[model samples]
Target: MIKPYTNKAWYLVLPVFALVAFSAIIPLMTVVNYSIQDIFDANTRYFVGTEWYREILNDTRLHDSLVRQFIFSGSVLLIEIPLGILVALMMPARGPGSVVCLLVLALPLLVPLNVVGTIWQIFGRADIGLFGWALNSLGINYNYAANPMDAWFTVLLMDVWHWTSLVALLCYSGLRAIPDAYYQAARIDRASNWAVFRFIQLPKLKNVLLIGVLLRFMDSFMIYTEPFVLTGGGPGNSTTFLSQTLTKMAVGQFDIGPAGAFSIIYFLIILLVSWLFYTAMTHNDGK
Candidate 1:
């Protein structure tokens, strides 16, 4: 028997759709409007179609920041993904020990972003901070404030310390969801730990890894608050990422037209990269 489809239930979703349109669409349209025009004031403005975009595209600062953003995001993914998997594998699988492990692992994620940066900022001081003091005592020249490489290393280490727990937790949940029969089968087959993990665990972790990779990539790419608080995009602009650049243009310099154009470009880049990640992961899954 054929049944006619009714869309009456869709009417119930109208309010939610309207709210999203009001919140997101309105602001986005405003940015687009600003991007296309040079605004002198609320009453005084001139249409300058794509001028800001052209200028922004040619800006060398943008090029540098974009390159740095990619490097930072890539480094985070390479370190965090494997380190997270290792941590998850080492976590207690049962009893009160499991609860304790989860709590400890989750602690870093609970800290506020700015606070995490502040903690690290203080912790990395060579004067009184234990980390810097210890390194200096060992005759290591570790001043993140003055050195670009040190700043980069500190930022990377801080990011890993703060966010690796998220990946570990996600992986742990994925591991827990696997049926015990798979483990039993591996045992009966006399499988090596490496063989079992390589064939069984790794394949099962694909979806979760995809999720972790996408999330970590996006977050790392768009990262601003922590680095801004910690480094202020200083040490010779070495840590000045795209977000900081945008902020300097919009908030610091009040270049509304150019900032709007930059914002659009930034949003597009994120959208495109995220789409690529999703496509690649899903394509691999299908194979």
Candidate 2:
């Protein structure tokens, strides 16, 4: 006979839920309040009722930054996913070498975002940076500060360097979770290496790949610090993403109402895209 389930386990999680509500929901509600108001000061404010939202929706800066953000995010996913899988494939299945490889791959992810930007900023400098020096020495002209393409290249390269490891680690874990019986079965069938990977490994990795893609997409979409430090969204705003634009509105220009609306819309876009990703990936699962 099945016993009645106890909800005592929920009591253990109530504090964590309450903390999340206090931290996230409260601030989100405040932002929603701000988005509908025209705030001249703490004391002087008027209800604008979606005026800011309408303005932000029409703003040309929003359009450009949205385009740039998508381009950057798309580029990141395209480059990192395959590269990460390849790196994971090359890693030893069981050995000290695997430990060392995992550790090295994790090092980049361990570095703080601001520090990653700073590291790359100096590293990409034409005057004293090793990267810049080598390129110049090899008769190539590369100056991220002055060149738009180079700045784009630098930001993309930095993101790939910093985040590809996350995907690899996820893929690696998925790989390790695969039972050895599958490999033995493949061997008994005399399956080619490509067949083993395609029919066995890749199939098992689907869930992890989905998780990795979502994590990377969301994180990359919200990026601000790294590019800001590396290029300051400079060389004529070539690398200016939606986050920087929102920052400029909210902090730099102090357009709180518009910024709040922009942020809400930004949040919605991310939510929508993530939902789309989840739906597309899982659509075939039920079949």
Candidate 3:
């Protein structure tokens, strides 16, 4: 006879659940409370119902930011996903060389987010920065501070430099986890490199790629610190993303109710898009 599963072990895990409730759920409920009320001060607040959400939904600022955010995130996924796969394919599959490559790739990820922004900010300056100086020296007329397209290019490049390694490392681990028997079988079939990659390696990497895409998409969508320090959402607001917009509303303007509403909307958009990415990527699993 099969015994019923006992939940007594869960008692040991209860503290972790309580901690989550205290840390995340409580703050989330507070934001929910704020979203429904207009606060004039610490002691004064007026219930506004769903008014803030409706207004935020209609806000042109939100519309523009949403469009820009999607474009940036989309560009990130398009560039990093393939680039990462290429880098992984090029990485040594074993030996001291693999260890060295991993160390180098992991270096960028070790730097703090704000530090990465500051580094790029200085690095992209046409005055003294080597990257900018070299571009101007080449007669390309690159000035990120004065040109919108330049600013976009700089921001995109900065993001790629900083985050592509994360994808590469993930893909590399996935590649390494693949058993040698698969490669042996491919060899027996006299498969070309392209055929092997397209069929054997690529198929095995699907889960890893899914995780990378989801993570990159989420991070890119919510990106703030890098562009904020690098551009301050300038070059005519060309780089202003949803997070920056919400920050200005909440902290700069002190619109508690509206900011709360905006925050909820932003969170939902990321959540929905992440779910969509997961679904679309994993759709072929059962087949």
Candidate 4:
């Protein structure tokens, strides 16, 4: 008789499932409940039947924030992805240099988000700040406090400086995982530097690059603390992203009903986009 396959091991997953339900599902249900109601006070709430959702969909403030959010996230991916690959390519694969490079790359990630923002805030000031003084010395006309473009550029540069290391570290790990035989084969074929990168390195780094892209996208999309501390969503809301908008609705304005709806929509959008990214990246793995 043939042996029957069994799945009794699934019982081991019960605790994890329970934890997820408690942490994620219960909070989600609370948000869902809040989204469909109007709250007058702690003691008064009335059902509004998707009014908040409709309001959010039609809100121009939300639309503008979404646009700014996408632009910031896109710019981060554009810069970090290529810059990471270049950094990884230049990294030593062996010896003390590799260890030192890894440590240096990790330094930015080690700093707390709020502190990073604070550092950049003081570092970019016009009078005492080195960057500001240098720019003024060069007659560059830079003022992050008054110019919208300067504010955007400062936030962008800060983000790039803070997070590019994450992408580089991920790419480095992926590159280091490749077998030496692959390099030997490329050498035997007399592959040009571009050909080796295009054919060998690029293909191998695909999964890691995908991971970097998704992680950076999600983090950048929800970014709040750093920009909030650095620019306070000024000069005139140039750096206000989705999370900042959500915070303004929920905490700043205390519009719980609409904030709940916004939260649900925000969660759904992130989930949908992450799924799309994952699917697109892994679609060709089977081939």
Best by TM-score: 1
Residue pairs with backbone atoms closer than 3 Å in model 4 (clashes): none
Q: Which is better, 1 or 4, measured by TM-score?
A: 1
Model 2: lDDT of residue 175? 97
Window of ten residues with lowest summed lDDT in model 1: 278-287
TM-scores for every predicted model: 0.94, 0.92, 0.94, 0.94
Q: Give candidate 2's root-mean-square deviation (CA, Å).
A: 3.1
Question: Tell me, what's the RMSD of every candidate?
Answer: 2.3, 3.1, 2.6, 2.7
Better of 3 and 4 by lDDT: 3
Q: lDDT by residue for model 3 over 1-287, one digit each (tens)?
A: 99899999999999999999999999988889999998888898889999999999999988998999999999999999999999999999889999999999999999999998889888878899999989999999998888989988988998899999999999999999999999999999999999999999899999999999999999999999987888898787889999999999999999989999999989999999999999998998997
lDDT of each: 0.94, 0.94, 0.92, 0.92
lDDT of 1 by residue, 60-153 (tens): 9999999999999999999999999999999988999999999999999999999999999999989988988899999999999999998999
Backbone Cα, N, C clashes tallied per candidate: 0, 0, 0, 0
Question: Global lDDT for candidate 4?
Answer: 0.92
For model 2, residues 25-129, the per-residue Cα lDDT tens digits are 989988899999998888999999989999999999899999999999999999999999999999999889999999999999999999989989999888999
| lDDT for residue 278 in candidate 4, whole number 0-100 | 93
Total backbone clashes of model 2?
Answer: 0
